[model samples]
Target: MTGWCRRVRRFVSGRHPPVPSLLFAAAWAYGVTGLFAALDPLAARWRPGGGTAVAAVTVFLDLLLMRALDDVRDLEHDRRFHPERPLPAGAVRVRDLVVLYAAGSSAVIALNAAWSWRAAVLAAQLAYGAAVLAAHRRWRWPPGDRLLVNLLVSLPAPVLLHAYLYAGYLDASGHGAGWSGAVAVVVAVLAAGYTELAKKITRAPRPGEPAATGPLGLNGSVAVALAAPALSAGLLAARSQAPSAWTPAALLAMVIPAVAGCRFLLGRARRPCAAPALHLLLTFAGYAALGLAR
Candidate 1:
């Protein structure tokens, strides 16, 4: 039992440090919810409340669950290419993660159920996650070695998470944003994709490592990374009632990733991993500020 506890501690500390992970989840919850409320005509004066708090907690736990499942799903690959990771390095056992996942998922469901019909949305996300896990484990669908294919298959999870947040906001405010909610989802997904691609842009990937640079090459990967955020910012500005006010902030937020890409192209040895994270932080913070101001 003590050994298991130690492993769990090591895994959590290494893979999902609580403070930063919780902060990221909270930012995502508030930022996405705020953006949706602002975009939706019916959600005037929508303020963060108990529902938003619940959503933040739910997102934090759900993200942890996703991390556990992903680590398990990629165990074999990690053993080959990322043996330093917790699971591959024997710092944590699969059953330890299973226990953590079960506890975290139960908390998420209970929190959602107590709050609103957001429980249904949460359930759908969980079901989809389970289905994907099963497909990977049982049928080996979308071959594990194919990074782009796996990415496409996994992209819907974030979209569903964004939808779940929107649903929670609606439940709290008793108002719907009509088409703006859908647009918000698209914007959020694009931001997520941009971050994912940006972090993995490399000229030389380790043997069997799944990176966008593998198929797209360094320049092509960087281009796509730059493009996703630009398109996302454009969509966000187009959807905003005050595009003139918001467009500049969005563009400014984008400069981080652009500069990172430029430095990377100039033959920087270390990847600018921090750039994508900063871009996300700035963009989301800007959106949340704009939404709350309105």
Candidate 2:
């Protein structure tokens, strides 16, 4: 709003009144995911935590470059509500973004070659990125297919989480990471389903035609609830089997925010209001907790 602040925003965004779009991407995807990366090191059995380090590095690259480009595509409509964003306000450095995206892709590919399992992870991420670009091109297509694409595209976080859990568990000489990985898989699917259902409810048909199911209605809510206990169970079992300074505290702490957030989202779905970026707060807190837990 002030002259000095405006100049700073413009300098970073490449135009007047920076859109805060990049900031959003950084906080929501990178910052929080960084936490997952940090915590992931703890979950793994590898010396010095190679998998966790690799995963964190690669994911950050995926988000900044691939996701930010997608954000650019939304400039036309986003301007209405987000006028200060880079694309809408014309402050984002298009050339810089172009370079950053290319660099990120190249870096991930190189890193993928460094690890066996990681190559698969990188592939999945690329697949998701391509899917998003395709979906954006066909945004006006049938809502159901669009929803599916969105769900599939948003799955990298949980997938990465699973990779850590799987490798970590197996490394510890415990049962196959497959057991924990299965839980992660189920959670990923359920989370996507709930979100898709919630979004559907948010953008339902005409007012006259009633929505038989509310946001996160039966299928979605139940699915999320199921993931909660599975994760909590893992945490609790970890604590019970080997009580430690970090295990119990981390296990229990996440429950509060996770439950509260789920409840808050469900309520907000019924009637929405601006809350000064509750998403940023949620993501930061969640990711930080996850990382510190490790």
Candidate 3:
């Protein structure tokens, strides 16, 4: 029992540092959910409810599972390059992480099943995640191509999140976003990809690290980041039923991050990673708040 407890501690502390993880998870939850709220006709106000809270929890768990799996799959690389990380530092073992991943996956399944038929959406998420991990392990995508790699890894997150929310909303409201909803989904997915790219490119790479931004040069990456919100705003404006209160605020929220991204690219900022992460969070939260706000 003691041994198992110790392993759990190491695994949780190493793989899931609470402060940062929870913060990111919170931001991500709100951000993607914002998209759902914006499109939901029944959401007369921008106030999150039981469904939103449930979705947030599920999204957080899914992200946590994916993070653990990535560490497990990239154990060798981490050992070589990121030896201080929990897995590489021997603070946690692969077997322990596997168990953790399995448990987390089970929780996600249970949560989604209880929420509604959203279980299928969660299953699809798991499948995509598995495929991505498999590719990373087998194909060895170019490390220098961090933008594409990050996009491939992170895109499914927003998609699955959207699916989960949509599944519940449709089940409850018996409606869909139709063509406008589809556009919003595409916008959200692209924002997610750009956000992932920004997270990578903003950080000044260590000397021996792979190219930080891949084919997305500093300028290009920042541009994409800035554009994500702009495109979202355009789409929202086109929607007849888009939440009026959230629309402008969300656009402003996106602008804040975009400007910060610009600063990082210009070397005015010392580092790139933190700001972009915050930016992504705000964008999601903006949409979520708008969607739920009465």
Candidate 4:
């Protein structure tokens, strides 16, 4: 009902303004594990329990934590240019976000420790958080630092998911090719790097000053950048499964969202009315692309 309350809700939970939806990203991440493992020949041996579930839980938490921090870091800047956001509008308590993020991070690592080897993947991803903080504090910059953080963090999500899946397959069926699985996981890392770059160059706002809302900046380009990998990965995944026929359909599925995401990213700021649906679509494209990479 009130302005501040609306902003806070928008920041912490909603689909527009303050940020994209972390919850959606986490749920999509679960799909990354499911699809990769299901397609693996080792899927026969891949059990649902063991460290695999633990890894899934950790990855989900990590997505939430990282996404929250990104908003926290951008609070001041967004408020100046985009006041509808929770931090800028005073709807969400910025100080409280740290505690929330920490709790999630702790829980993720604890679950990861149960799986031992899998924990390494989590730590690798978590380390990127610290790196981002350092870059922000030490360098007083954003998109570049943000890009590095994205690539670093992205590497682990799919790789770890694949690892857990492949690990289970090895344990149960003893049939998985460890090296081949590792290579597929690496492809995911590369795809994330591309997404990071897209986010960096597209629709990007000026770091300190907000640009008048327009379609030419970092964010807009990012909307398109998200397309590159989503398109490629969808085709690859379809090729893996259907080769001739299904591949085109899969590629189409990937492209349609990308086009919709671009449409949203370009139009949402003006419409505000259509923002939630658009942001949700953008988040879906991002997560699906990552999952497709796996």
Candidate 5:
């Protein structure tokens, strides 16, 4: 048991890094939910409470669960390319991740079940995640070798998660999503997909590593990366009740991705990968602040 615990710890440290992962989860949960509550005319006065806390915990666990499942699903691929990763290095075993997924998913389901109608959304997310795993294991149809197709297939997971968060906010506030909710979900999804693409737009990827540069080329990849956040921000501004207040922040946030793209073009590869992450974090944080200020 001690050895198993240690292995899990190794995996967490090497792959997930608890501190940043928790921060990302909390930011996503609170930031997205807060934005929905603040932006939705019907839920403008909604504030975080017990349901908010529950949602944060659920997001954190769901992230860990997804990480575990992905690591397991890609174990063979990692052995070929990322041999030093925890699972490939023998620091963690498949069964260890399986246990983690089982426990974490059970907690997620139970938490959402007790909280609100968010359970139905959570169920759909879980079903989609399971189907992805099963499909990957059975036939590998999406083909990890094709970065674009694999990313497209993977996009729904985050999209469903955003929907789940929106649903939780609605349930807690006793409101309907309306068109505002739909717009917020689209914005959040675009932000997420943009971040995913941005991180993969490296000029010099390690051999066999999946990168958008390979499929879209650096210029094309960077262009698409820049486009997503811009589109997302435009939608938010159009939908926002007080666009003047948030528009500046949105514009400033846009500079991060642009700078990151320029850095990639200039061959400064080391730090550019982190740009989208910071951009997304700031965008979400800005949204939460906007909601609270209003």
Candidate 6:
């Protein structure tokens, strides 16, 4: 048990930091349920504890699988560019990671299966992940194409999460998230993409190093991030069900990255720093609160 715990720690340290991962998963649970509440309050009404557990587990497993796959795929690149990373540094073996991945997959399947037929949602996520990994193995896109690649890779994430929640909610409440739920899903996807772009904004790359997402500079990244909230606000407004719930969050979402972008522009900071990510975490909380508020 001790050895197993140690390995788990290594995995967390090496792949996903524990604090951020847990926080992100918690926020996601709230946001997903909150969106469900907004779209269909009656449908969203269900046993809180069970719903929370399902969302937390689904998000955590999704993140874990993504990190593991990325680590595995980028083993060589990490060895060269990020030598201190666990897999490249020889702190953990690929075999161990594979075992963990398999175990995680099983757990995800079982959790979703028990929750509902929603295990199929996780299965779709797994399928997309596998396809991306296969592509990475075959043709490594140039760094210039990194932005597009990142977007494509992440596009399915919101769908999977939504499907997971939607399926479970249906099973529990015998109703669906409705059309507004689609808007929430779009908002989630755009938020994720924006965060991806924000993280890749580099304050300073070495002489030979390119911008993290190729040619996308601070301004472009910020713009990408800003677009999410603007669109989300519009969607929330159109729904008219709980505009109050999402309005502030949408505005704040736009503001956080915008402020970070300005700082990056003025040379006050390098990259968007952690502002965009932190904002995303807050947005999740806001959405969750909005759900509960309703």
- Count clashing residue pairs per candidate: 0, 8, 13, 13, 0, 0
Instruction: State every prediction's TM-score relative to the real structure.
Output: 0.91, 0.52, 0.82, 0.60, 0.91, 0.86
**What would the per-residue lDDT of candidate 4 be over residues 65-86, giving only the tens digit for each residue?**
6766777767666676678765
For candidate 1, lDDT tens digit of each residue in 180-228?
Answer: 8899888878877778887766777676666556577667767888888
lDDT by residue for model 5 (33-118), tens: 87785567666565678877888888888888788878878888889888999999999998898777767777788887875567
Q: Give lDDT per model, in order.
A: 0.79, 0.45, 0.66, 0.49, 0.78, 0.68
What TM-score, to 2 decimals, does candidate 2 have? 0.52
CA-RMSD of model 5: 2.1
Residue 207 of candidate 2: its Cα lDDT? 42
* Alpha-carbon lDDT of model 1: 0.79
- Alpha carbon deviation, residue 106, candidate 3 (Å): 1.6
Quote the positional error of residue 185 for candidate 3 in Å: 2.4
Predicted candidate 3 versus true structure: per-residue lDDT over 143-213, tens digit per residue:
43465666656577667767776766555445655554565577667656555655555455666666665
Scored by lDDT, the top model is 1
Better of 4 and 6 by lDDT: 6
Q: How well does candidate 3 match the true structure in TM-score terms?
A: 0.82
Identify the runs in model 3 with alpha carbons over 4 angstroms from their true place.
1-5, 19-27, 40-47, 141-146, 202-204, 240-246, 268-270
- For residue 230, give model 6's deviation from the true position in Å: 2.9
Ranked candidates, highest lDDT first: 1, 5, 6, 3, 4, 2
TM-score quality measure for candidate 6: 0.86
Q: Ten residues in a row with the worst lDDT in model 2?
A: 271-280
lDDT by residue (tens digit), candidate 6, 7-105 = 667877867887778778877876766766665645444345676776786788778877887787778767767888888887777767766777888
Best of the two (4, 5) by lDDT: 5
